[model samples]
Target: MIELSTVYFGLLGIALITYATRLSGLIVMDFFPLTKRMERALDAMTGSVFVAFVVPAFYKGDIGVKLATAAALIVMFTTKKILLALTAGVLTAVIARAVLG
Candidate 1:
């Protein structure tokens, strides 16, 4: 029972809010100068996100997770390719869970 006008206005509101938020970030960054420490912190933030995701798995995950992590590390060290290693690790975990569980 939703009307077209309602959907249109809802989408327009979302677009306006998203654009304003992104534009505000650009405006603030333009006015500020990035220091060396700030640059390093920003760089580390990227890896911190991934580490945050994996750290929890190590703490509470089953044997499948451990094997997957070890496989991922081995592939990363051997091939030096992150995407391939991640895919392999995920596939390994899926297969391990299917077989073991």
Candidate 2:
């Protein structure tokens, strides 16, 4: 069995890396300026990253995740409101799991 300290340190390392990545942009931007093309690429990169993370999970996840994703997509597209879409999706997954259990 792995020791608790090992797990704690591993999690700490992950947290530090995440924090550094999030802050690196601001730190570098302080001295370096972005061109319009670079800025647009950065804007698209976030969405691409989000999709990269989510798309694989959507294909592999459970029924609840599938239903929630479908509901969120439909609502978001129809209404063009992210908050409501997110709410509807989460509620759908929670209720689906509760009913299933």
Candidate 3:
């Protein structure tokens, strides 16, 4: 059995490491002047990172998850609003799961 404190400390350590890694990237990038190419690469990287996180889940998800992803994508494309898309997706997943269950 795991103690709660152990879980909390482990999560804290992970969060700190994550923050450090992000901060290090920003610090390192500051040393170099940004070129047009670098700016484009950075812009592309954001989308790639988002896709990297989302693709695996989409691939392995069940029907509810698929529906949610579809809903989010449609909302995102139509409204171009991230927060609205996310809300639509979450609501879709909840409603889908409840109805299916």
Candidate 4:
């Protein structure tokens, strides 16, 4: 079995590499002017990336998680407040887990 410290260090390495790549992107972008097309693509890319990260887990998560995501989505749509949506999601998850389990 893998050691706990090894897994911890592996995660730290992954995080550092992720940060480095994002930082490099920012650094490189400074040298180039973003055209309208590029700006549009970047804006679309953000939503695509969000869906990529969320869709799979949303597909496979437990009932509590699904309900939490729904609650969050509703709150976000109605309030346009990220913090409140996140709070609703958390509270929904807690209540759903307790009730469902």
Candidate 5:
């Protein structure tokens, strides 16, 4: 039989290991030389990660939430107006909640 204390310590150890592994790259990255290709790759990686997080939030979300967010993204992309896009998205969400709920 596994002791509760042992199980807790085991889980904690796993979490620490995972965190250390993820952070190791960031910690060591500065040690390396930055080439033009590496720089471009890093820039693209930022946008890719942003899209990865945002797309699922829009597509898999509730209809109202998705539509509102999509509208915001479209506006932000076309006009590059951050404030207007944010206001439109928030208003859409508020209206949707008021009407739907």
Candidate 6:
């Protein structure tokens, strides 16, 4: 039988491993030289990761949440107002939740 303390330590170890894996690129990438192709690949990877993170949130989300977030993103892109965009997004989510529930 696993002790509770052992389970806690196991979970903590897994969390640490996950964090380290994510951070390893940032920590180690600078040590190596990036070729021109590598640079372009990195740039494309960055955009792909950004869209991958954001797109699902929009498509899989409720209509209100998607609309609110899309509006906030558009406002941010057009006006370059980070705070306002974030506020709008949060407010939209809250309002959507309230109304939908």
Candidates in order, TM-scores: namely 0.60, 0.70, 0.69, 0.75, 0.62, 0.65
Candidate 4 at residue 35, lDDT? Answer: 85
Instruction: In candidate 2, list every pair of residues with a backbone clash.
Output: none
In angstroms, the error of model 6 at 98 is 3.2
The C-alpha stretches of model 3 lying farther than 4 A from their native spots are: 29-43
User: Which ranges in model 5 have alpha carbons more than 4 Å from their true place?
Assistant: 1-30
What would the per-residue lDDT of candidate 3 be over residues 15-99, giving only the tens digit for each residue?
A: 9999998887678777876788988998999999999989998999987899999999999999999999989999999999999
CA displacement after TM-score superposition, residue 25 of candidate 4 (Å): 4.0
Give Cα distance to truth, residue 6, candidate 2, Å: 2.9
Model 3 earns a TM-score of 0.69
What TM-score does candidate 1 reach? 0.60
What TM-score, to 2 decimals, does candidate 5 have?
0.62
lDDT of 6: 0.86
RMSD of each: 5.6, 2.9, 2.8, 2.5, 6.2, 4.5
> Candidate 5, 26: how far from true, in Å?
11
Best by TM-score: 4
Candidate 4 weakest ten by summed lDDT: 24-33
Task: Write down the lDDT of every candidate, Cα atoms only.
Answer: 0.90, 0.94, 0.92, 0.94, 0.86, 0.86
Candidate 6 or 3, higher lDDT: 3
Query: 53-94, model 2: which lDDT tens digit per residue?
Result: 999999998888988999999999999999999999999999
Model 2 alpha-carbon miss at residue 89, Å: 2.1
- Candidate 4, residues 2-101, lDDT tens digits: the string is 9999999999999999999888767877798778898899889989999998999899999888999999999999999999999999999999999995
Q: Candidate 2 vs candidate 3: which has greater lDDT? A: 2
Work out candidate 5's RMSD over C-alphas: 6.2
Each prediction's number of clashing residue pairs: 0, 0, 0, 0, 0, 0
Q: How well does candidate 2 score on lDDT at residue 53?
A: 94
